[model samples]
Target: MAQIVGIGLLVLLLAFFTVFTYYAPHGDKAMGALAAAAIATFLVEALQSFVIGDIFSLGFFQEAGTEAGLLSGVIVAFLVALTMGVNPLNAAIIAVSCGGIGLIPGFFAAYLISFVVKYMERKIPNGLDFIVVVIVIVPITRLIGLLLTPLVDASLLNIGNIIVVATEASPILMGLLLGGIITVVGTSPLSSMALTALLGLTGIPMAVGSLAAFGSAFINSTLFHKLKIGNMKSVLSVAVEPLSKADVVSANPIPIYVTNFVGGGLSGIVIAYSGLVNDAPGTATPTAGLLVLFGYNPAAQVIIYAVIVAVISGVVGYIGSHFFRNYPVRNTDFD
Candidate 1:
């Protein structure tokens, strides 16, 4: 309960921070959406404690973490529609794709950057070398979890030996300490999803709600952006991409970025509570991190939650792009 309060406070502060930062833009809609997300976090947590507990088994936690990813898909939907400049009437497509393929953009964008820079590296002319970022590309950011997974079991073993040596002095503290040590060992960031499975602690349904809100907003953005769709043309033969060109979808990524954080984080917290942990050795990131859930035997509520997130993501992305801000990319004067 207290944690929910803490989360609400953080979201509120974040909301103010977002608005203050955008003071020049003064986006009332964007600001309002942030406020809504904060309120949502509070309501969802409270509901999870009372209603979900009354109605369903906590066994749903097994799917919480995976479920969170659905909301992030909205961000993907927003980006895709913005990039293509498709019209508002076509939002359904954006919603569908975002729900279906939200993670591909980031992963592929990273891949494209890598591929292009690497290709330019060998082909750069001597005088042109400085002008080109031929070598300035790295795809797939490394995750900390991947590198540290090996030491998990061995470290636990060493701690167990230490506890054995201390047992004669004060067994209670030693036992307490031992329990603490094993708990840490069991919940290693890389391994907790599986550990949760072993413990069978089906957490409440906070995570599913998180997923639902995220998906809802994402779908909302997608549909909204679709409604505002336009087209673009390059004035220059070779494009001079800006530092933040990644944001130059047919619309901007600002709204989507904000949406992803709120939506994604909520989903993550829910997953943690739900007892769903990603067991894959590598960092559970990108879509594969969560979409992997589709493979799991999810609680019935989670599937519904996913569909909702998809719809919201599309809707939010659409409205956010068209209503709040206009993109320069959609208005290039090629002539």
Candidate 2:
């Protein structure tokens, strides 16, 4: 019962984020901004600090990457605010206030403060609005971020721990669950990148997530092409990055998501046995995820496993398409 509750709470939190992305003002863009920030901060740091710097003993990359990782919250806060329509100056101010906070906390604080800033702009006269924002918004945003950081971090970390424990107990079961859900999320607006980052997942769990998404690129691409859902460009787009064709995928969720789940699960099983570890938190992206895999494991091992994952995903996509071939699908045009 306790385990059930914990799992349920994690699902509920993810659902809330999904709903919020669709309903909240500029939520989708905010999330896109968040993804970009994750790439800029986490991905860069992961590649540079771990792969290049540590491997080559390059101090410059190591220090530079560490600096980027440390500023993740500030970058997330600034970009999210800017994407949500906050002016550049005010966004920077809010971001600076979020310095040293965690990414999720900064995101929430900046997002909520954007509304306040906008309201002040509309209600308060221009001459005084800037003054009010300078005086009122920055500190409040910082305080909120500071207060939320520990709570948010703790909650997400607890969820990660649960997953880790489950994985240790039963690798295949956890692999299937994480692989399928994270891949489905990679196709959805919720974004696997954001999810993994927020969870701060590492080790086998992170490897599962990264490979799952990597395999999903092939799964989605093949599925999209075989289903005749869209033209070549759209097919290629999803192959490179599922989020690029998110609308089409959303429109045809049944086939796309179901196939991704199967493919991702298969890939996850491969990862579970391969023993590849990804210490990077947010490299669950497709291309980046695959590249980062080499950082933690040997080239030959990573290559062999990645090929296995790709073949499994590709086969799953081909087979899944035939199964769902007769199923009704909405055709979409990329142009």
Best by TM-score, which number?
A: 2
Output the worst ten-in-a-row residue range by lDDT, candidate 1.
Answer: 235-244
**TM value for model 1:** 0.29
Best model number under lDDT:
2
lDDT of 1 at 319: 53
For model 1, the superposed segments whose C-alpha errors exceed 4 Å read: 1-224, 227-251, 262-275, 281-290, 295-301, 325-335
RMSD of 2: 3.8
Tens-digit per-residue lDDT, 1-335, candidate 1: 33234334433533443343244232322222222222222223223322343234463542443344333323433333333332332222233333422232322232223334335545865445424432222111112112222343333334334444534444433333322222222111112122222222222221332232334334323423453322222211101111111112213334433434334333433333344322222112112223433334365645654554454444444555565455332311111
What is the C-alpha local distance difference test score of each model? 0.31, 0.78
